[model samples]
Target: MLPPVWEVVGAGQSLYEQGPVAPGTSTQVIADVPAGSYVALASCGNADSTAMWASDYPGIEEILALFPLTSFAIEQGATVITVPAETPAVPVQQSPSFGSSQSE
Candidate 1:
């Protein structure tokens, strides 16, 4: 698995660390982001292992079927969308039902 790139959308800022960071190891990256509700993308760059196993599949079409290159090739990385800080509560009214009535 390749290290992922995290991009902050609408902010034009990104953070990345080149790694085959060892399992259980930790790393950090920082980027200045502007304030606003937005999303981020986590791109795993190129997943080289797809071919290592895919080589056994035997045909171009067959390999592609198992491992979609689009998933591995996406440059946009991953996304981190923001949730609205507060949601306004809607005031629901109890509607009155009409009952049968005898009238002149």
Candidate 2:
């Protein structure tokens, strides 16, 4: 039997698209993560395992929504983290008249 499949989504853009990952798969950050909230989805057991298994398991979309950004621990199993964008610094303006006065 295979492990399970996990997917991560950030804001409107999907960081990690739906896919099957091994049970021991290392946690990875999702793409397009905004400075705000996000979601994650996971599915256990293989689809072809059995009808009963599939029926008992929750859908990917449903599971993803169930796991909110707040619930995720910084150090834990497959989880998503929010990354803040860096702000650009403003350029300082120089006085044009100061250096030109003595030239005349």
Candidate 3:
């Protein structure tokens, strides 16, 4: 039998990401990305991101299973990406209605 494969390839870049997908919970795979960046895509749990995954929702039977996690690393010469500072959200206020009555 051949080993399961997950291919994520793009112009000279190689990727083989895999993992499980649990209900209502997201799977996050973090990686160090460098400057002079190109568009990078992240997928949590999906048909395209699994090796031998099985799920009732999508009707897949397991062939070979993984605990559901993957790793990403930046190249030695590439700069790592950083998280931006969070900003507070301002509350929105609505105008009050005049003389309104309702019955159920």
- Please tell me which predicted candidate would have the highest TM-score against the true structure: 2
For model 1, residues 11-76, the per-residue Cα lDDT tens digits are 445444555655564756644544444433333323574432211111223324555544332333
lDDT of each model, Cα atoms only? Answer: 0.39, 0.41, 0.35
Off by over 4 Å in 3: 1-16, 42-104
* The 10-residue segment with the lowest total lDDT in model 1: 52-61
**Every candidate's CA RMSD:** 15.0, 12.8, 15.2
Model 1 TM-score (2 dp) = 0.27
- Global CA lDDT of candidate 3, please? 0.35
Backbone clash pairs for candidate 3 read: 20-68
Clash pairs for candidate 2: 15-31, 40-64
Q: For candidate 3, report its TM-score.
A: 0.25
Better of 1 and 3 by TM-score: 1
Candidate 3 lDDT tens digits, 33-88:
33333323333344564432222211011212333533222222222233434435
Deviation (Å) of 81 in candidate 2: 3.7
Candidate 1, residue 94: how far the Cα is off, in Å = 53
